[model samples]
Target: MLTSLAIRNVVLIEALDLEFGAGLSVLTGETGAGKSILLDSLGLALGARADSGLVRAGETQASVVAAFEPPAGNTRAAALLADNGIEMEPGEPLLIRRTLKADGGSRAFVNDQPCSAALLRDLGGMLVEIHGQHDDRGLLNPRGHRALLDAYGRCDAAAVASAHAAWRAAAATLADARATVDNAARDRDYLTHAVEELSKFAPEPGEEEILAAERATMQKGARLSDDLAAVSDCLTGSDGGLAQLRQAARRLDRIAGEDAALAAVLEALDRAVVEAGEAEDRLAEAAEALSFDPARLDAIETRLFDLRGLARKHQVAPDDLAALRDEMAAKLAAIEGGEEHLAALEKDVAVKADAYRAAAQTLSAERQLAAGRLDAAVAGELAPLKLDAARFRTVVAALDEGQWSAQGTDRVEFEISTNPGAPFAPLAKIASGGELSRFILALKVALAERGGADTLIFDEIDRGVGGAVADAIGERLSRLAESNQILVVTHSPQVAARGAGHLLIAKSSDGTVTRTGVHALDAAERREEIARMLSGAEITAEARAQAERLLERV
Candidate 1:
């Protein structure tokens, strides 16, 4: 329910704060006394289009703050708040504030947190619905008719939505699988050739590094082999160093028995012969170890070059060639078996589509039944509001397959026929301004138990009717207020008397500037106001008496 509305510098309303209560509240004043200003201010706070002209004559800006206390079990508003990343505790008030500048710019805030105007408008629709002759956002919009019907019928569309989602997902999966198989089929020859080539060569990790090192060593040994052979010949032949040293040692040993000096010389010659013989053996071993076949070296170099060339061709390092080969083999296998896989996917998609169709059909049947009941209930309410000759209907028609959605493939609209035997047409096309308001009222009363926004504002709904009709309109408004907070901008004394709370809007000028003010009426003040409504400019004794009776009747 709307707890209070604070408006500042908005047109004729300079500064006004109005507190509202439960049940029906009526605002009454003479024409041009700024009753519309109050509604305009409320609309501004509820995210209506902002106009610079709405700012007071000398003010730089205008602002409105509307506070609401959502019912305990209302989750729609809470969910919206959460989706916007705003937190609000249960039973807490939801405050919506809007400011309009003279430059035609505006800002919106919810609970003091800045938000977008679009978000504020959406939240406003969930909290308050203003029904006037020109209202297009609520009941009058054909787009929202389906949701309203579902709410009225208490029908759940979750199963249909879930089934549709599953079907679409399956179809998407099938599409992706088909694309993969088609692409693979186009590349089948390339995959087959690559896999065969890799299997034959069988490149191993680290093989390139080992072969390159061996090649380098063989090249160096080939360069040094001639020098090693020359050194071996000097050490081992008859005139070589080893042979000459042994001959000197034998001569010295034969004279060693005759002199001590000769014996020392023989010992030195023997050590020299032993060292030269060891050197010759070492040179022979080095020659054997350095001998490598040129053919072996050529084979190692060829293998290394082949491995590097293959790595470059596949755009991979030599070490990764093995893994790439395995991957190609797997793709070839999938291509060979793709037909069976494609068949499985097609069957799954068919099953999902069938489930979705069944769910949508069931929901459509329930909506058709709901449409009949709704038409009857609205028809029953028409006669009391002076629309006795009119007929109202809820049209439930199937949409084309291309237009099908999670909402169950049906288009729902409210239609009416203004005269007896006239073909029913859409509400907007057939009814006049006054008849449209009444038709909306009838629909509201019939669907009252279903639930809507906490607050409902009706602007001059009783404008064209009076006597029993006005009384009937008041009675229904009173009934609707039993579950909703109703604020009616009315001129009818009967409707004014039905209000549990009354506010009087009056315009005043003090020599220079004119301004509008709203006053909450007490019991005596309410009676005088209603009497003024009945007698026009002058209050008469009879009008007061009639006003007393009107008040008592409520």
Candidate 2:
């Protein structure tokens, strides 16, 4: 239930603070008394869209705040707050504030802590529902119709929980199956190439790096092969160098007999000649091995190209291809054996679908029972509201094939007939403004305990109504207050008389500034306000006596 509302610098309202009680409260004034402005301020605090024009002429920003005292031990409120990352204990009061700047930017807060407008909207939805004169379409919506039926049936929580769980389970199974199928299709071609490449190379992890280094060294030496060959030829490869050295050594050895010094020199020359011959032979062998083979180079290029190409195709580096191949193989294996897994998933989906169908059917049956009672109750409310001929009907249609959803498959709508012998139509299309209000009142009255948020606000619910019909509407609102707080802005004296509290919306102009003000009415003040509503701008003794009798009768 709302505890208080405060508004600052909002259009005609410079500043205002209003406190609420736990029953039906009425706000009354002549037209243009800023009754709509009050509701708009509350809407702004509840996270409605803001416009910079709502700010007062001299003010840079407009602000509104609403405070709520959530019912003790209300699990729904506690869970909702917790889910939003708000820290509040059970039974604690919650405050929401919204501020808008002249530049059109806005900020929202929960419990004075910075929050998003979305969060405020979410919390506000749980705490208040504002129905205005233009809102006759709420009951016409098929989505809300089911909720109404559930509230009437008192099975909303259980039915919604079961359907949500079943839908999620089925959705999960379908998603997993779809991902498996997509992966198998993507990897179909790659799997064969991967297996072939791994088979041929049989390459150890570091084998490529070692082989690449050896190949580079050998190629570099091979590049200078022609120079090495020329050196070898000049030294001794089928050439005259070794022969000349041998002849010189022989001539020196023969001449050594003539001189002993000559013999020593011959011995040194012979050792040198032998060393040169050994050196030439080694050079010739090295020249022969230094030749390059184009065929080996081609093989190395082809192997590297295959690894790199495969890596590019798979969006991985060449070295990481090994891991990618293994992963692809695993996926292929899963797909190959997908039939067994797919069957399991299908079974699970079927089970959840059946569970959802059963729950929806059971809920539908209960709704049918509840619908009869609702129709009876609404029909009883019609005569007093001057619509004795009108008919209120809850229509339900089951889907041909069960549709799994958050709210189940049964399509529900509230239909009405405003005149005798007329065909029933959707409530939105059939009812007039006053008729809709009366119908809404009847619905609210019937499900007062089970329907709605902690606070319900009706802006001009008594529109297009007066006399006995107006009194009937007021009676229903009073009954609705037994379970939830209700606020009504009205022009009907009967409605104002029925309120446990009455507030007067009056506008007073001070020079250039016009401000709207609200004041809680005492007993005498209430009578005067009711008299004014009953008469007009002028209040008479007869109007006062009538207002007094109306109050007494209530």
Candidate 3:
């Protein structure tokens, strides 16, 4: 329930603080008494769009705050506040505030923690629902209609659980079959190409590295061959280099008896010739062994390029190609096996879908029975609201084959006929403004203790109504408050007298500006206000007596 509302610098409301109590509270005032402004301020605090023009003329900003006292340990409210990062003090009320600047900038706060407007709106929905001529009709929402019907019939909990289980089973089977199909589609070409490529190359895990090392060695050998040939030419292939040295040594040996130093030099030159001859033979052998082969080099280059190209194509290193091939093989095997698995999955989905259809059919039958009762009840309520000849019906249409959904296969809509011989039509299309309000009231009364929260506000539902019809609307609203807090904004004296509490939305002036104000009325004050509403600017004794009597009867 809303415990308090505060406003500052919002339009004519410069500053206002109002507290509310439970049961049927009515806010009554004449037209243009700032009643709509008060509701608008409350709506803004509940996260409605902010308009810069709503700020007071001399003020730069406008602010509105609403405080609520949900039941202790309300898990949904606690979770919602926590999700918004709002702190809740022990035994303290939940505060939601909105600030709007003249520049069109706006900010929202939940328990003093800054938040986005969308988050505040979501939280506001859980706390209060303000229904008016333009407000979103919670009852008309198709998404919630079925649950509402079940709630009204007290049959929701079991039906919802069974339906959810059926849905989960069906969803699981569908997911499995779809996964199989996707895998087959994705892996078909990949497997075929991988198998074909790997069959030809058949690369080993470390073969590329070994081949690369061998290619380097061969290349080095080719480079060394040139140096080896040059050395061989110096030693043996060119002019008589070694032969000339040997001839000189032989001459020296003949003169050895004349010079001892010449004999020593001859012996050293002979040893040098022997060593040089051996070195030349070794160099020639090396040159022959290291001779370049174009064919072998071409083969090595082709293999290396092929390996590198395949690596790039597959986005892997040359060494990882073997691993990639193995992975592709595994995927191909899975796809091949998928056909059988897909068939099994289809069977499973069919079974679960049939089960869901069966449960939905059962739930639909129950709803049909409950709908008959609800239609009869609503029709009975219409007569007292001055539509004695009107007809009410609950239309439930079945889905065709292949048009199934998670929410079941029925479309429920309210239909009405305003005359005795007229055909029933959809409520939104056929009913007048006054007729719709009465229908909404009856439906709400029937579902009072059902799916809705603990608080329900009906804004001026008494519009375009007076006399006995207004009294009837008041009676129903009072009855609704038995299970949920009911708030009604009205201009009817009959409706005002019926409330457990009455609030007057009045405008006060201080010569320069007019501000909206709210006052809780005591019994005597309520009587005088109802008299004022009845007589309109004149509070006669007879009007006061009528107001008092109207309160006594209802």
Q: Which of 1 and 2 is the better model by TM-score?
A: 1
The TM-score-based order of candidates, best leading, equals 1, 3, 2
- Point out where model 3 deviates above 4 Å: 71-92, 157-330, 400-403, 421-426, 430-432
The local distance difference test score of each candidate is 0.88, 0.80, 0.79
Tens digit per residue, CA lDDT, model 1, 1-554: 89999999999888999999999999999899998899889888888889899999989999999998853556787788889987777667888999999999999999899999889888888888898878876777788889888988877899999998998899898898788778878889998998899889898888878888888888878999989878877877897878888887887787799998888888888888888878887877777777778999999888889889999999999888888899888777768887898899899999988998899889988898888989999989999999999998889898998888878889999888999899988888887676777888899999884647888899899988889999999999999999988999998999999999999999999989999999999999999999999998899999999999999999
Best by TM-score: 1
Ranking by lDDT: 1, 2, 3
Model 1 / residue 117 / CA error / Å: 2.1
Instruction: Give the higher-TM-score candidate: 1 or 3.
Output: 1
Q: Model 1, clash count?
A: 0
Candidate 3: how large is its RMSD?
Answer: 9.4
Provide the TM-score for each candidate, comma-separated: 0.79, 0.69, 0.71
* Better by lDDT, candidate 2 or 1: 1
Q: Model 1 reaches what TM-score against the true structure?
A: 0.79
Show the lowest summed lDDT stretch of 10 residues, model 2: 133-142
